[model samples]
Target: MKFNKLPLEEPVLKGVQDLGFLYPTPIQEQAIPSVLNHRDLLGLAETGTGKTAAFLIPILQFITNSPNNKVSGLVLVPTRELAQQVYQDAQALNKYCGLKIVSIYGGVGKFPQTKQLKSGVDLIIGCPGRILDHMRDKTLQIKDLKYLVLDEADTMCDMGFLPDVNKIISETPTSKQTLLFSATMPEPIRKLTKNILKDPVTIQLGNLTSAATVAHTAFPVPSGLKKDLLLHLLDKTPTGKVVIFTRTKYKAKQLARDLSKEDYKVTSLQGNLSQSQRTNAMNGFRKGKYDLLVATDIAAHGIDVSEVTHVINFDFPGTTDDYTHRVGRTGRAKQSGQAFSLITPEDKQLFNQTKKKLDIEIPLESFKDFDYGIFNPSTFNDPIKRNSQTQSGETKPKKPPHFYRKSAGNKYRKDVNGYRRSRSSSSGEKMKTHTSSNNYKRRVRPKSKSKV
Candidate 1:
């Protein structure tokens, strides 16, 4: 149905038309009605499916149509980036409505936020931590709160902000209408809905998996050669805006630097970066100033860059849910995109699990020029296959291996008697092997006359 057909105020409808949104997305079409009817709602939809607009439109409508406009609406998000994004969406949708909206998030100075809060905003979009800080400082009050939205509920749980979320919810009025949205409904989010929502209308659009428009491909390479494979793939693959996901902030920064050195327009979005740096990186990437954005899982959710052409997982995510969010960065808004992952032998278990859980076949691809034999799964210490000691019923920790100094040629020669000798130590100084139950270290004798 068209957005104008929905029960929305004239100002809200005008704002919708100003944004050129003619028809409602499936989630918006289904969930907006329940939300407008002043009932609690639980919406399950994947990224890039217009979930933000679904809640924002109705929230804005209620605020515009309300007789008393206190600080009635509050939206709790998981990340600073998401807070800003939703704030912008709210601004755009509240154009004709002229409702006062303020975005409160950490990573920036609080003076501006305090000023805005004191000035009396109609709605607030903020992260849980910053919102709690404001609540503690008594700068923002929500006792009379009417509409409360918990966007990306699963992400907040994953990021360990559930306690803060619950605290914030407890401070709000119990009679308020609550709306909870998530891509996947894990046990924590399920319990959350039961407690926060009151007979909510549940609207689930798709399966709890990655987007169907994304074509998944895995390139098996050695751990040490992941960077090489990434460079090669970037050179060969045609992409507009590419997002590369790494597991650590350090990896994101280092990879972004490496890509910059290779003359690729790149930036990094991770937790370690300063607030301004993070904002600049995200804004630059979104505006096409940078072709590649290397980020941690912080950017996995609530980032609404609809034109992303590709997503590369430099480090395979730790869980299937993380994998879904990483790949979901691309294939947004029904646009087809490619998701490439550099899979090491160590990721074999997670790789298998992801395919099985997502119920999709991710084709193993090999580059014609890159070598894939550098990492041998058989030789690699597979955690799945423990040592023989475990089979022998030995529970004690294994002894540390002895380390000897390298020879002049950096090679050790094995004699016929099973003894190892350095080529430079021809003076009959044979390398001795020692086994000890406790942690042990053997010092090599220096060439000097004094013993070390």
Candidate 2:
């Protein structure tokens, strides 16, 4: 259905046309009417299925009709990146309607956010943690809120934001209309809906398991050779835009660094970076400044990059739902895309479960000329180590070996000297070293007062 076919106001129709959206996505087509009727909605759709517009269009229409200058609509997301994305989408949708929208999230100055709240906004798009911070400071008032949306409800549950979400919901009036949109409805998300939504209409677009447009392929290699396989695939496989996923932030950063050193336009999105750095990385990727983005699952949420031809999973996600979310980045907007995952013996069970549960037939591919040697768990610690040797029997220059040791409940890295140094891990905390090389022999350091 088209935007004009719906009961949207003239201003909304103008905005829709301005954005060049002639047809509505399946989710948007079904969700807009339910939201227009003021019914609670539980929308099940994948990331690239226009879920953001599904809720934003209806909410913009509602706000445009009501003409509220105070905060009338609230959208709670799991990550700051997602919050910014939703806020930008809302602004675009509200262009003709002239609704005041503000996004709030941690890792930045709360003063500016407070100033925006004090100036008064009609809609708020934010994460739960920053929203709670504003609530505590009495800078944000939602008692007059009429529409509440939990975008990516499943992700919120995964991030342990349900309790904070409930508290924020309580701050709003019970008569408010609630809309929950998720790719998959796990038990926790279902429970959240039961407690929050009232007589909601469920709109399920496709099978909640995986995206239909993505072609799934897995390459099983020894863990030690996974990075080599990744490099081989990336070098040979032609793609327009690509996003790589890693299990940890450290791995994402390290992988991106290694790829950049190889002269690839690559950047990383992870938790360790400051808010500005994250924004720069994301904006750079969106603006086509970077061809590849390596990111962890949590940090990659709310990323909507068009023309992403490939999604490479360097490390298998913990759950099938996460795999779906990662691969959903591609094959968007009726475009076909490929998903390649570097699978190893450790991910055997996960690979089997993903195939069985998601009903996806992932054909295994191998590099005919590449060596799949015996798996060494230590060599898998860093991607640079994997590329040390080439197919032509050439070796790259190796860096100094680092050792990890636990001392007095604190983890530190031991260098060539008999001193311990601390480094940041995926969690952004100074912890034990994560990299080890087979060339270096393990040495135990004696107790010493010197710290390096």
Candidate 3:
């Protein structure tokens, strides 16, 4: 369906025409009408599927029709980059209509955003934390809010911002039209919708399991050799506008730095960077200043870079949903792309689960010149266990260690080297340390529940 065929105002249609968008995307084709009808909407769409425009267009139309000077519309996003992108899209669509819109996010100073709020914005696009701050300061009031949108709700849940989101939602009037959009809906998001939306129209554009446009491949490699294999793949594969995902912020930064030294136009986009730095990295990546963006899952939601040729998983994703979001970064706008992951024995379970759940074939590829005989597990912080061959030729990892170790009344003692050692019982009991690699777990504490 075309934009003109939908019941859009003349100014909104003119803006759409100016952008040269002849036909509405699949999500847009269905969601715009439901949004226009003023019904609560729950839309499931993949990344880069024009879902942003789908809701933005109808919201702009509603605001244009009413022309309320108060903050009538509010869009809550998960990241600063997404807030900026949505603000830009709102500006482009509201050009002829001339609606006062402002984007508020953390990372930068609040003085500018305060001035904009003081000037009286018709629509507000912001993250939950900063918006809650504004509400507390009495600078921004949304009691008269007519439209409320929760974009990238799953990302907010992942970032531990759902509590703040709930607080913000409690402030808004229940009479307002609510719209929730996500690429994939997890249980938390579903629970959120149950509380926020009332009998909403559900529009799902595609399968929620995986991106059909992406070709999946897994390279069996030791965790120690992942970086080398990534480098090898980068040298061998043909790519344009690639995004490499790491599991942790430190890894993303270090990998980006290491790749930069090798003359690769690469930049990191993890949470460690300031707002300006994040914006610069994204802008540079979009403008072709950088060919590669090494990021955590923060970039997985609402980053609208076009023509992303490949998504390389330097580390295995934590869950199947994570795999979906990471791979969804590529193959956008109906373009076919490739996703490659370097897997170790530790990642085998999750990889197999993802493959089975997505019901997709991921061929195991071996580089012709790379030697697979050099199996090194000591390079990792904890050694990766390998399957032992038995008499019947069945392979199984050795029995796992006991969970709790027997400790004496003096629990821990510091050795001369300053390392803490667990004391054994006075009965001369041997303390068996659980050296199983899977026993080691890393917990990343959220800096702030309110921060994006």
Candidate 4:
């Protein structure tokens, strides 16, 4: 459906045209009307499904019609990055409407936010923690808040921000219209919907599986050879604004550093960095300053870069939902995208589990020239198995036997005998031996000495 046909105000329609949005996505088509009718809505769609516009457009229309200078709409997100992105979109859509919009979040100063709040904003886009802070200090007031949107509600639950979210919701009037949107509807989110939304309209766009427009593929290689395979794939694929998802912040940083060393314009977004650093990385990637962005799941929340042609999973995601969110970054707004995952032998179980849960077959691809060294799953049982049968049968040092240790106060007792001795409570005597051992040494090692 075309956005122009929707019951949007003239100013909002002009803003939509100015932003070059002629057609409405499926979620937007279904959600804009319900929002315009002031009905509670539960929008189930992944990131980049035009869910932002689905809610933002109607919100702009409402605020433009009412012309309220006070805060009427409140959007609670999980992260500061998402808050910033949503605020930017709100500003763009409300350009012709001339509504005041302010984004609030932690990890930065709150004085400016308080000043903006005092100046009176029509809408607030902020994270849960910072929004609660403003509520506590009475810097931001939402007593008469008309519209409440919990964008990425499932993410807020995952981040353990539901308590803060509930508190913020409590501050708002119960008569307010609530809109909860998420990529997946888990049990907690469902319960939240029951408690908050009053007879809301539920809109489910796609399944929990990957997007239909995205091509899912995997390359099974050893952990050590993943970087080589990624480089090969990057060299071969015709990609623009590729995003690589890593499991850890350290890995994202290191991967970005390594990619940068190879002369690829790469940056990273992770929790460890400062807010300004994260903002810079996101802005740089959006502005084409970086061709590739190596990030953790934080980027999977609300990153809305339109030119993302590909999403590469440098490491397998922790869950099927995360995989969906990561891949959802691409194939957005009806645009086709490619999702590639670098799989190691250890990740096979997780990959298979995710595939089974999503009920989607991810094709396995291998490069013709790429060399996948001897990676045997059976060799995992015996580390020396591969080296022991080399062409030049050279004897290598066997790995040390594993030992268990228990800490007694500051000192550690190494149980080389493989059996822990129990003391009789009544007599304070050692119990009978459960196993026989040749070495029975009771050495008192200093607690200050480091164990190797």
Model 2: clashing residue pairs?
Answer: none
Where does candidate 2 stray beyond 4 Å? 374-452
The global Cα lDDT (0 to 1) of model 1 is 0.80
The TM-score measured for candidate 4 stands at 0.82
How well does candidate 1 match the true structure in TM-score terms? 0.83
What are the clashing pairs of model 3?
A: none
lDDT at 335 for candidate 1?
87
lDDT of 2: 0.80
Q: Candidate 2 residues 58-155, lDDT tens each?
A: 88888888876799999999999999898898888888988889999999999999998988799899999989998999998899999999998999
Kindly report which residue stretches of model 4 are placed more than 4 angstroms away from their true locations once superposed: 376-452
Given candidate 1, what's the lDDT at residue 352? 84
What do the candidate models score in CA lDDT, each in turn? 0.80, 0.80, 0.80, 0.80
Q: All predictions: root-mean-square deviation over Cα?
A: 13.1, 13.2, 12.3, 15.4
**Shift of residue 14 alpha carbon in model 2, Å:** 0.5
Clashes of 3: 0
lDDT of 3: 0.80
Score candidate 3 by TM-score against the native: 0.83
What's model 4's lDDT at 153? 90
